[model samples]
Target: MVATTLRSIKSLVPLLDRVLVQRVKAEAKTASGLFLPESSVKELNEARVLAVGPGGLDKDGKRLPMGVSQGDRVLIPQYGGAPVKVGEEEFTLFRDSEILAKINE
Candidate 1:
C-alpha cells in the first residue's frame, strides 16, 4: 500500500505547517545494551526534513504560522510519525507540533 503511495523526495509543506518525520535508519544491536543506527541517531531531535505539506488553517479561515522551512533540520517527537517511502527514501509524515525542537547547527 505505502509502496505505491510514495512518489518523490520533495515535500509540499505550506506556510504554516510541516510534514511528519520518520528516521531514515533502523535500530542496531551491540554488547552495550542496544544501539541506534547512525541515520536514526541524529543530533538531538534534529532530522533532515524529508517531505512537508501545506500549512494548517487558522481561526479566520486564514493560514497559521510555520517555523522551519523544507530541507531544514528539525526535531520531532520520539514516538510519533507514520512510516512511509518517498522515491527510494523512507520517511515519516508527522505533524509539526509533535516535533520537539529544531537544530540550526
Candidate 2:
C-alpha cells in the first residue's frame, strides 16, 4: 500500500496556494564526531520547496504570486501540512501562509 504511494511524485503539481516541500534529514553525527541514534536526532523545521501553486484566488478571482519558488529553502511550521511519501522520500504540502519563513542560505 505504501509502496504505491511512493511512486511518481514528480508528476504532482500543487494547486493554488499550496506548496510541496521535502523535509531535510537530520544529521546522524554530532559536532563532537559521535554518532547519534535515530531517536535522538531532532527533526528540523527546514525544507526545500519542490513545487508551488499558482497562488490562491483573490476576491476578484485573480491569481496572486507565490513568495517562494521551486528549489528555494524554506522554514516550515513544526506541525500542520499534509504528509506525502514518495519512494522512501517524505514530503509535505502546505499553504503559502503556513510556511514560517524563507532561509537565505
TM-score top scorer: 2
lDDT, model 2, position 69: 93
Clashes of 2: 1
Task: Kindly list the per-residue Cα lDDT of model 2 for residues 1-105, writing each as its tens digit.
Answer: 223454577788999999999889889999999999899999999999999999999999999889899999999999999888778777899999999899997
TM-score of 2: 0.88
lDDT tens digits, residue span 1-105, model 1: 155353554543423465745453433545587876666644344477755666678788776655555677777766766666667766667676776777778
lDDT of each: 0.60, 0.89
Poorest stretch of ten by lDDT in candidate 1: 6-15
Q: How displaced is residue 32 in candidate 1, in Å?
A: 18
State each model's C-alpha RMSD to the native.
5.5, 2.2
Candidate 1: list runs displaced more than 4 Å: 5-7, 11-16, 20-45
Q: What would you estimate as the lDDT of candidate 2? A: 0.89
Q: How many backbone clashes does candidate 1 have?
A: 11
